[model samples]
Target: MATSTPYSAPLDNEKFLYKLVIQLLIFCQGSHRLLEPHLLAIGAKLRSGANSQELLSELQAVSKTLVHISKQAKQDVNVGEGDGAALQNNYLLERLDELLNDAEVPLRFQHQTSLLKQRVRANLSEDSYKKVIDSAITLLLNIKDYSVSEQKGIDVFLGDLSDRLDELGQDVEIAGQANREMIDNRENLNTEIHRQVGSLKDSTQAAEELDILKNQTAEYLDRLLEQLLEHKQIEDERQRDAQEKIELMTKKLQELETETETLRVKLKIEHDKALSDSLTGLPNRLAYNNRAEMELKRWKRYRAPLSLIIWDIDFFKRINDTYGHKSGDKTLALVAQLLLNNCRETDFVARYGGEEFVMLMPNTHAFQALEMAENTRKMIQSCGFNSNGENVNLTISCGISDFNESDLHDDVFVRADQALYQSKQNGRNRCTVFAA
Candidate 1:
């Protein structure tokens, strides 16, 4: 494939990528930039199309989640749907973590996104969302590098993602299933109630017949009083038996509920921390490794397209050296903030270490990753530093690499690191794809 665009114009693949991304974001139904970092990490390791598709589907799912949440939120009328609010909030955290996340994404962006999510949640209308989606499509169609083939590819990707979204769209199917189950249970309950009522009616009729017989037995007055006493005793025994049955059902129900609660809490804790990058609020190392492993396995199984990017701060030691540790810390934080700001929710951004950032992009190829790496490189270059009252200009060198099942994360790292070294040698503040 040709790497360069037409001579007269500069092609922006990132913008091209984002146009679809924006539309998909809108398509995700107003879920608010919720993305999963682990999926990108996994995409890097894809050795099969199946794995790549799986990761792509995951990314698509994030978009679907946004829509689902938006619809659910608009439907929520109560002032405080406590648990609902928490779930929505958790979803928001997970979603925002994807887009506005990095080892050093700015506090300002975080603040802005946090505020916007709240507002968006408050009154997200389909019409407003439609406007955003229309604009997103327009912006995408206008990009200079958007060739017919590229545009077609994007549309195809969108189709695939849409298909996956549609598959997930049946998320309501589970609810419907539960409702059906409830209906069945109601039917069973009604049947049991009727059976009990029938039995009670039969018993009542038998008692009434006995009472009439006794009332007509004037010659056997003693026998009539004795039968009435026996009837009262039978009623007491029936009430006692009914109470015992209720107690047994209550105990069994409570036990089952406690067990379910325990399992849910345990599962949720593992899931929440597993995919999170605590220090930077990006995807954690565990998530990255697991995702990469999963994607690689999938790639090996299905032969799908995938790629990786390793970009770190240039001369990071000097920043710590010249600016002191606090400034260094600030710089790292700032850089993390930058990565978070620039990336899509589906893009994974994690701090590799003291001054390095890595991204795992599943649906994108090497060239696209390179373009993105360049944009990041330039952004960091232009992103002048800030401390008490001083300003410092900075630059970053980046490296790009693609991978497969035969390729280990370590090998990919080596290639990208070498590429990064080349970028540095070539004069920092640029991107280099692995030549070897």
Candidate 2:
């Protein structure tokens, strides 16, 4: 029966078992597409009507192959089981957190976004993730609306400012021209009065000398009196016109002053905003540049000891990647506050740019600045940072350089930066002073 099985399955049981095995293989192949290739090979062998032993051997081979594949699938799934999954999730969440941080919004929306970003975590539950995503979407929409409204407001403000400035300029020009014309008219009136007075004196002397000329003198005096009266009327009209023009000019000047005051206030606000860092509320790079230039000038004039310290947050990017950008911002603000609090009132501290800060210490030598920087580093290292209820230890590196007799403004910065690089290249969380 076994030998004849290929040509004719003699027993009904054999034929039934064969049909059952074929159907089972078909069902498994359909269910598990991964096993299709192995199953297809087995199916081909079975269709050739091989003997029982050959079929059994082929079945065992396919079963072994399937088992190996199943193990590999489990391993693949387990690859993201622990820290790997958290890292992957944090990668995406950090990106979202960065977007939230970079968005410009009103204070209210900013607060909302800050809260939302704080909730970002590497190991978020599905529900928590969805909630955060929905909140982010809502915050983004609100920010967009606010931006549109703010842009319109800015446009209107600029238009009003421009119009006021133009009006002020025109008023000043008109006032100046009116003053010039008034001065010229006054001079000409004085000249005409002097000439008329001289002519009247000469007529009086002639009238007293010749009685024959008395009638002519009387007619001339009457004509001179009429001319004097006309001149007086003209002077009165000129005085009225000058008074009116003075009042008009005074009102225009008052308006101009008011407009100029308004523009000054607006410009001051804009200037402050431009020089301030929105993130940490510290002076920005522009402010830093201005301060540095002023300090350099002072150093040159007085030969005062002026030291520059460049501070960089160690592993700042890692903080953002591991925790979130919100945490990174918080860290920056905290560090800024620390630096501000520790520095002298006369010292200038500014946020140079992301994760870096510059400090100008007037009347301080490089050694003194280095000491201060070391203390700051130690303070930062000891300070505890909590993100998502977890403690994150932070550290900072600093480089110090002071102005020398021959050093340019940029030379100090370059030396400090190089020193900072050295501090980083060496073990971080320390301070290094430039040698030269």
Best by TM-score: 2
lDDT of 2 at 399: 91
The C-alpha stretches of model 2 lying farther than 4 A from their native spots are 1-67, 70-89, 92-213, 278-280, 289-307, 312-334, 352-356, 362-366, 377-436
Error of 2 at 102 (Å): 7.4
Worst 10 residues of 1 by lDDT: 99-108
State the RMSD for candidate 2.
Answer: 9.5
- State the lDDT of candidate 1 residue by residue for 348-380, as single tens digits: 777765567788777777788888777877888
lDDT of 2 by residue, 1-436 (tens): 7877775745666677678768869678776666677677768878788655667776777688779878987987887585586676667777786565444446566667657766974457867877887888887887778768767876886797678667767766766776676677667666766776677667777665576457666665676677668766766776676677668767866876886688678767757866887788889888999998888888999998999999999999988778876688889999999999889999999988778899999999999999888888888899967898999889999999999988898999999999999999999998999985
lDDT of all predictions: 0.62, 0.80
After superposition on all CA atoms, what RMSD does each candidate show versus the true structure?
35.7, 9.5
Q: What's the alpha carbon RMSD for model 1?
A: 35.7
TM of each candidate vs. truth: 0.44, 0.58
